[model samples]
Target: MAFLESVFAVIGDLTWGWALIPILVVLGIFITALTGFAQFRFFRRMFRVLWPGNQSGDPNAISAREALLVSVGGRVGGGNIAGVAVAITLGGPGAVFWMWAIALVGMATSLVECSLAQLFKRREPDGMFRGGPARSIIHGLGADYMWLAMLYAVCLIAAFAIGFNAFQGNTVAGAAQDSLGIDRIWTGAVLTVVAGFIVFGGIHRIAKAADIVVPVMAVAYLAMTVVVILLNITAVPEVLSSIVLNAFGLEEAVGGGMGAALAQGLRRGLFSNEAGLGSAPNVAATADVRHPISQGITQSLSVFIDTILICSCTAFVILLGGVYVPGAEAIDGVVLTQQSLAWHLGDWTQYFLTFILLLFAFSSIIYNYYLGENALSVLTESSVARNALRVIVMGIVFLGAVAPDATSVFFFSDPLMGVLALVNLIAIMMLLPTCLRILRDFRQQLAAGVARPVLNPEDFPDFDLDRTAWTGIDPDRR
Candidate 1:
């Protein structure tokens, strides 16, 4: 395991460079600048459109709320908690600042990706909307990029479905075991069963489950964090100072140099929100939205919630609790957060994190499974093949539960994620002009009193938007 982990680590290092960060950062800056920081202007309207009871109707598409729920289901998971904890422990409290910065940029990255996915989304034979990298690659870059896009999807299934799923299973089982003395094997077995139930139900099931759980779990976890922060309000100033001081290479105040802080913040933020990773667009593509930009804005909101709200809240809990001592003993992700929580809330704190992790981990397994399904669907439409893949996913969930090595999981997953980012970012960069064009069109229609901004597929030059009888014409089908 260690040997394999080392090899994977080397691969990850080779694929992911410090240079890519600035490239993505610049891409994000460019998009926001070009769009006039649309995220800010659309945020309020986004909430109104995405919130429950306001979802527009479509023949074969999910409600806007359901789309947001599916997107959030994928975004808000164990990474928001444990991933943030790991960042603060290794990167210093100041890493939180960088994480926030990434999410702000990540929102733009997400909008671009989802916009492209929407622009190129396809209606599956099953009458469901299906689109993502595969559709986008074929539509924007042609069949030439098909192989590369499929290659990316395959890598993503392994990295997210197999590798990251293992980490989540282990985290949930381990936390439960440590907190309640439940046997890890039993925990794994139970989780495997629960995941199987959700997987067999497909995307709608997964979205519904996430809709019910994501908001509830997120609120519960945030409330706990709020309590912790308020109780330790006095330490808030020092923690914020530590974060700012560390962000700019101030080693004297932060204790560690800027590199550790920057890397920690960047890596954790990347893992948490998965901005450039190209995972959430799969979910975004599944939604039934009138305009791709509508879902894109909705998804952009999700990125903010994942990294900025949930992940950032976890960081504040740890840093404000004052449990993080830079360069201290070796501590695992959730364990460090657990210890920090316990410092403020006593024994009850452990249970709180344990429950949160279990919910988060379970949600992650479903999400990873959905991404795998979309990737497979992109290649073939075999039901048998789909079921077989589910079996494999379940097997991986069980295996990951029993695994003990952390580095291996991360190492194996990291390179694939970098590859995914490269492919999707390239696609997004290539499609930027179209994405901006769509945003402008949507904004114009809104200004013209088009209360519901549905566009005609025949009118759009890029791709079809209708999920049923698409025929590349809008009013003909509707």
Candidate 2:
């Protein structure tokens, strides 16, 4: 086990520290500049597109709003809570600043990939849509790029479905045991059963579940954090100062200095918000909007909700409650979050946090399953294979829950995800032309006084497209 950890750590460091970290940062800035920073420029329009004036009569159709919720559900998972705690534990308060920087850049990266996904989406047999980097790479980049698309789908399945889901299960199980004295096996069992119900149910069901759960959990958690902040309102300045000063190594503290902070922040922040990682594009592609860019805008807002809001809330709670010991051994996870919340509110709040983490974990699990399913749909539309994947997911969930500790789970997930995201980043770079064209088209429509921009297949005559999916989309209808 020790040797295995060492191996994964090596792989993780290479994929993230040396390669992906620089590529993601530089590409994010370049994409942001190329798109005229659509993420920030269209910031106001993001909210307008979030809640439709009215819902479409077809309940099964995935709306832009539902897609946004599903993306948010996936984004605001264990990564926001336990992952943030781990970041601070290993990278120190300085890590929080880097998290913010990554997120800011990530918002723009997300806008482009998700928009391309929407433009290149295909229709499912059930009349739903499915797309991501894989489909976009195949269709938008020409059939010659199909190999890259398939490779991406495979990596996405490994990272989101197995690697990351296992991490979520491990975090929840650990939290439950530490706070509520529940056994890991029991937590795994409960999670597996609840998750299976939604996983087997299909995409609309998952979206519905996300619609109900993500908003409530996010609001409740934020309100609680607000209370914690007010309680320690006087210390807020100090916490802020530490986040900035420690970020640059201006103050003497742990986190090993700025390099550790940047690596941890970039890697973990990518995990939490998933801006450039290409995961959210799967759900974004499913959105039933006339224009692809609407989904892009909606998804960018989710990055904000995940890192800027939810992840920040957790960091503030830990920093304010004074439970985090800077420059420690770097070995805490969700339990640290629970302890800090309990310190802020009371012992009972630990129970409350456990409950919240369950919501976070399950919603994310379902989201991860959908990504796997979407990726598999690209390889084979076999119901048999998908069902087999479901069983595999459940088994991995149980195994991760029963694992000795979070460190082992992190070893597998962190680096595996880095490799997975690297594939998508390459695809995003390849599809840059299509992405910029889609963005320019959307901006032109808005400038022409079109309140709701819709993509017409006729407009994109130069490119191959899935017409059935966009042929009859109403421009004025929600």
Give the TM-scores of the predictions, in the order they appear: 0.92, 0.93
Candidates in order have lDDT scores of 0.78, 0.85
Model 2 over residues 1-478: C-alpha lDDT tens digits?
A: 8998899889888987689878989999999899898888988887875555734446779988898899899988877888899888877888899999989889999988899899889998889999988888888888898887887888788878988888788878988998889999999999998898898888999999998998899999999999999999999999999999888888746637877777688778987888888899999999888788888888899998899899999999999976788876654677788889888888899889888999998888999999999999989988999999999888878888888564355466667777768878888888898878878877887888777777878888887789897874364542
Poorly placed runs, candidate 2 (over 4 Å)? 1-11, 52-57, 328-331, 403-413, 472-478
In model 1, the runs with Cα more than 4 Å from the true position are 1-7, 58-60, 250-256, 405-411, 462-478
Clashing pairs in 2: none
Q: Worst ten-residue run, lDDT, model 1?
A: 469-478
Clashing pairs for predicted structure model 1, backbone only: 94-243
Q: Highest lDDT: which candidate? A: 2
